[model samples]
Target chain A: MTADPRDLVVRGLTKRYANGALANDRIDLHVHAGEVFGLLGPNGAGKTTLVKQIIGLLKPSAGSITLGREDFVANPDTARALCAYLPQGALPLSSFRLQEVVELVGRIRGGDAPAVRRRVDHLIAALELDEWRDTAGIELSGGTRRLAGFLMAAVWPAALVILDEPTNDVDPLRRRLLWRLIRQLAEDGSSVLLVTHNVLEAEQSVDRLAVIDKGRIVAMGTPSSLKAGDRQSLRLQLSLVPGVDPPAPPPFAHRPIRLGQRWHLGIDQSDAPEAIRWAQDRMAAGVAEEYVLGATTIEDLYIRLIGREDALDRAS
Target chain B: MNLFTRWLRSYGLMVTWELRSLRTVLPLAFVVQTMISSGLILGLGFLMHDITATQAQFLAVGVTVVSMITLGMVMAPQLIASQKQSGAYEYLLSLPVPRTTLIAAGLTVHSLIALPGAAVALLIAWLRYDIALSVSPIVIPAALLTLTTAASIGFALAHAIPNPMVTSLVTNVLIFVILFYAPINFPADRLPVWLASVHQVLPFGHSANLMRAGLTEGLASSVGVSFAVLGGWALASWSVTAWVVGRRA
Candidate 1:
């Protein structure tokens, strides 16, 4: 059966290298039109490889990709025509000025000259890239170059836009602006595949998401849905006073993850009152200085699903 | 658009992009290539006092052939490897243009940039050696074929070989062998029978032979075979390049 032109459908997608390392297993997912779908995963979680396959940069060892009523494997040019990709790092067009790189991609990706100029101007201003507009890509800061690359990826009218870690290396203020632009892109009816491990920000942004780990999707749903999946579970995080022997985390069903002076404990939602009661007892003893009890976050779900927190925690 | 028009547009875009980026360095690149290619001939002129007319002619034409060889065989791999290493290769692939159009445009840009060096070498040789240069109708076509064949071989190797570093070194080795060891600027009889036989099959020797035929009239003992060999080499090089560039790395 054919998929709608407004959707990107991947079925039984697998990428096994000649050395027999399965980078992507028999995975499947879909992103409908006008939705921002995030593929959240830790490093080496097969997110980039899956996107590369979808973009025709790598051939799937098995199964197929259906994008906009065409098989992406059979008709990749058509698939590419309907998509725009912002790869993982900075824009690679070092020979051109920042603005020129944007306009060049616009034209090459099928925009007319006049329209390209106007669109490039709008994106540059919107992204706060005016100061560095005349600078060559080789000379621009990494953050500025990433901003330009993100803007260029959004220039053309591709139904599906793929962004791999769009906010990486960007400063805090620019990162906020970037998230705003992504929401605007979705509002304009582009289906965005945002591949990132920035769970907190992405939790607020994506309409739905899939958590992939070790070539398999361990979890899939909207942030709310995934969080709701474990409605029985809630997170208990406490910031203890410095150098106080942090008590044995009161035996959480799943091990508590420690961050600096804080200990994050997961418990059944029904046990929240008791957990808070226990935390309150510790607070009275001046052990836990501050505390936060809330529903499980996309990050908590991430740490639980991937089962490898230290590396991803530090990276994200 | 038709295939021809589409390719022409792509060629225009690629060439324009190349020239725009290279505006400041184009002059210097051309001058350096010319000097690097012909600098040896100038040294030979200055150093060799008792050189005969045959030796001077050999030196003149040999420098011209070496210029094209260096441009095609050595320069192509180095430049392409640099582009690939810099992530520019993926950047170009992400564009809407077809691979063939890009490759054609790249070859065109490379050949155009490379011509001035060979031309300068020929001019310097013409003046330094007082050699009689021929205005043969076949000269330009033969030169184009020789340059394109050598360059295509280089482009093919750059994509095929797993290690770009080694490919670059090998091109240098090939250049040295052709210049000093092969009978490029010397008599074929001086080389061993086995070495001469090897040159008979390889296009490097035929490239110089064809150029020699165009420069002077009576040296064409096997002109037909030389043309065939160079043309075949060009065709084969392009075929291999198409194969390697089309595959995923």
Candidate 2:
């Protein structure tokens, strides 16, 4: 198949701030048309820097970013014209009513007035924000404001839609609606770049994802492909009693991760029974509050990847 | 659409957005501005028991200039700094509109908001002092230049400084300097010789001179020099603001 002109191709993209800090180090990635691509990384992992460059807010230190036949870095106007961005904070809507903000952005993005009004109306109804339509931004709740911001970006039709932490502060029901809207955007043939640290949500939403750590893509693949190595292992999670020290991992278990009162142990499938027995014994002894055995998830893989990078840095 | 049409459309939309966003605050801003301008005129009047006509004209026109300066130099910087702190400025930059249009829209809205207070101040000055002001067409360019220069400088300061708190502090200090220290309400001759020389280069004194020349004929000297100085400052400050706005990374 011929390459779609709307595909976002970034080759050897790098960004080094003036303070000699490297934010994005020779990153390369491709987001095909009509694809839901996730950039999953923890805060300060260069995800935002990458998005900023793509939207032409930051000049890349090196490499090229092309959306269709246009160069994004060299032609930032094209980037602005073709990309719809929902920045990762409360939008500056304090003085504006929700409906006004959405419709204004749509019109500014060059949508016909009536068409934009219709689109705004549709989105407001879809997200069930009609009650808050006339409410000023300052009066809206955080979740409602975020939903309005989403509508502002989604009201316009663009080749690429970049949403940074769009689900942040959103209620669960609205978040589900947002995810559906995101899927709808992709289905309508727009490339959707979902920049978020929520691995569980990204796993469910993205067609493919890249895990970034320390300004580099540590791993990139479909969710299942990235988790394939852990397929033979079961994640044994133990929630210990408060103030109790974590129990030691069994010989068959990999290094255990302690997060607050919870301990996650990776064990082979064959060793699941022994792991369960150990967990049960700990619970019986009151050392553990509860235990759950589940398949390895993308969050585990993300932590493992970041941990590996940390180890490599120490070695070097 | 052609580039011009596109720019005009974007400019119109941005102006609308800014006005709507400022709807609640605009009335309050107008009230505060009117109070400051009218208060200055009436309060300063009490200080001088026997004021001459020239001094009356000076204070009246001077306060009008101060009202214009306050919007651009004090309020604009504060607003922009707030927007920067809230990440709204960055969001605006990321939009699919020409950056110049945003600046233009801001200037337009601010001018609209400030002019009413200025006019009210002038009316109060006329009614209270009964000053015979010779209104001339030069007042138009003079007012425009003063507002634009002050706003450009404000925008430049806000954008150049990374910390919003610092920007706020600096603008507060600017308001203080403009109100008391600057040779705006009084003649430069009243200040020390060294300070008078300093006022020659600064835009504040020149802004007052321009307004005074337009409002009361024969009251302001060196009209040509005042125009040149204000224009130069406007150009320089606007250049800095444009660079900051258009810059990437």
True contacts kept of each: 0.25, 0.84
Error of 1 at B105 (Å): 0.8
Q: Candidate 1: which docking quality band?
A: acceptable
Error of 2 at A2 (Å): 6.8
Q: What is the alpha-carbon lDDT for the whole of candidate 1?
A: 0.79
Stretches off by above 4 angstroms in model 2 are A242-245, A308-316
Per-residue lDDT tens digits for candidate 1, residues A1-316, read 2345778899999999888989899999988888899998888889999987887777789989887667888766666677788888434556678888778778767788999899888877777889998888778888888888888789877888999988888888888888888888887988899999888878888899998989998888888888886677888989999999887877554558776687878888677788988999999999999888988877887876766654254333
Q: Candidate 1, residue B141: CA error in Å?
A: 0.7
Model 1 misplaced stretches (Cα beyond 4 Å) = A1-3, A89-91, A229-234, A237-247, A252-255, A258-263, A267-295, A310-316, B20-28, B46-49, B217-221
Model 2 lDDT tens row, A201-307: 88988999999988999999899999998989899989999987777777888967776677878999999889889999999989998999999988788877775
lDDT per residue (tens digit) for residues B1-249 in model 1: 797887677677766666555555567777777886567787877777788888888788788888877777887787677667666566566666666766777677666677788888888888877987765877778788888888888888887776768877888798788787776676677789999998887887788887888787665468789899888888888888877666653
lDDT minimum window of 10 residues, candidate 2 chain B: B107-116
- Candidates in order, TM-scores: namely 0.89, 0.95
Looking at model 1 chain A, report the run of 10 residues with the lowest lDDT sum.
A307-316
Every model's DockQ? 0.38, 0.84
Span of ten consecutive residues with least summed lDDT in model 2 chain A: A307-316
Q: Rate the local accuracy (lDDT) of all candidates.
A: 0.79, 0.88
